[model samples]
Target: MLYRTLGGTGIEVSAYCLGTMMFGSVGNPDHAESVRVIHAALDAGINFVDTADMYSAGESETIVGKALKGRRDDVVLATKVHFPMGEGPNRGGNSRRWIVKEVEESLRRLGTDWIDLYQVHRPDHTTDIEETLSALTDLVRAGKVRAFGCSTFPAEEIVESHVVAERRGLGRFRTEQPPYSILARGIERAVLPTCRRYGMGVLTWSPLASGFLTGKYRKGGAIDLTSGR
Candidate 1:
């Protein structure tokens, strides 16, 4: 598979990252089959695997942990934070308290000592960007996370994060994960250029427009709305 450097981190990743959002009960309930799918992707030269703690209430990470057994060294694993994992107010967000606590939970679920990329799933308007960056900076220093980034953040927020990082002398976000596909190219306008200006890597989700452009839902064709995305 083709490879490219992940932003300024210099870590090489495959062109297509295997997104395991549907591995758990929310989508695919069979753990064995999910593991097999992960293995197949790895065997196909997909060195990057992305998951989120909020996906299937952390079950996806558990399945990923099972699949990456004895093969962790060959992969660049990424997982996201900033979503509510359970009941309670402090259970989620970009605050340092939540970030610090969630990273450990993610590590445990993944059965790995360190994560290649730990991303903030979305911006938390309530929390200061500096606070979030500070927490991630601490994770990198503590050897829990290799690098960190943001997901689905606007161009302005991305710039604000970099500014905060620079002013506060904290490690800046090395990448940005936004939704991009043939049907959804909004990021190309400003978010893409903003990332480029800061030399940040871009990882796009929903490349197939959540399967809408996968030829499964065509014009004048019967659509199965009940099917899983």
Candidate 2:
């Protein structure tokens, strides 16, 4: 598998990252089978594994932790935050409180001393971009997170984040995780360019348009809403 540096962080990662959103009860509930899938991806040279704290209500992280038992150091482990983990007001968002607390939970679930890349799952309009950046900066300094980035943020927000980081003298976002596929090319217009200008690495999602381009679901074919991504 081909490898590339993640943003300007100097850490190389495989071109294909294993996304574990469907590995838990929300999709595949079998722990042993999920572990096997993760192993298969690693064996295939996929050194980047991406999971989220909120995926499968944290069960996905648990399974990933199990899968990476002896192979953690060889992989560029990534996970996300900024989603509600429980039914509460302070359980989520991009605020410092949530990010600082949530990182510990993610580390525990992933069974890792430090995360290669810790990303915010989505933009939280309610929280100031500086607040989020400051918190992430602390994580990097604390040696809990190697780098931090945002996911699914628009071009404007990405720029705003960089500006805030520069003004505040904090760590800037090193990467971006956006949705990009043949069917969804919106990022190409501005988001991609913005990331390029900022020298940020990019990891795209839904490359198959959530399986639409897989040919398994045709234009006129009926799709089962209950299954598939």
Candidate 3:
């Protein structure tokens, strides 16, 4: 497991982050088996785990939180917000109110006091990027989160947020997570380049094209991932 520093944060994470998107009802619901996978990944030198609150309506985080019990110090834990956890309009967005409330919920579900990297699941176009950064900066100051970032953000938004951080003296985003796979190479055209330019660590999703490169399915073959477990 090759570890790379997360930009200027002085934190090292494994190249292959264990993604818990398939945990809970969407995949395996057995807590024992889910925990085993996490344990095996850790044993196999996976020091990073990425999950999101929207995954299976936060069930993934619950499983991951239980899996990391008694060994939280050994891994760099990350999770995302900014997605609807409920039907209400106020349930999601990068607003300071939601961010503050959501992180606390995330931490509770993860069984951890602080998240290593708290990420915005998506750009909340309805809210100001400056407001998001400012809220995240406060979380860092309060020690509720160590570092923060964004996922699936456009190149322009990433640059704009950085400028806002600089101008407001807020905590800058230390990482940028995007969708990068053989099939989806769009990030390479702009987003990846901007992250490199800004010295932000890039952690991408869909590296296997949703198992397309795994060779488990034939070309033009249909896969039923409905029963993910």
TM, every model: 0.97, 0.97, 0.96
Candidate 2 is scored at a TM of 0.97
Regions of candidate 3 where Cα sits further than 4 Å from its true position:
225-229
Q: How does candidate 1 fare on TM-score? A: 0.97
RMSD value for candidate 1: 1.1
lDDT of model 2, residue 206: 84
Candidate 3 lDDT by residue in tens digits, 1-229: 7999987799899988999998888777787898999999999999999999998889999999998989999999999999898888899999999999999999999999999999998999899998999999999999999999999999999999999998999999999889888889999889988998889999988788777677767868787876332
What lDDT is obtained when candidate 3 is compared to the true structure? 0.91
- Prediction 1 global C-alpha lDDT: 0.94
Per-residue error (Å), model 2, residue 170: 0.3
Worst 10 residues of 3 by lDDT: 220-229
lDDT of 1 by residue, 67-160 (tens): 9999999999999999998999999999999999999999999999999999999999999998899999999999999999999999999999
* Model 1 segments more than 4 A misplaced: 220-222, 226-228
Model 3, residue pairs in steric clash: none
State the local distance difference test value for candidate 2.
Answer: 0.94
Better of 1 and 3 by TM-score: 1
> Is candidate 2 or 3 superior in lDDT?
2
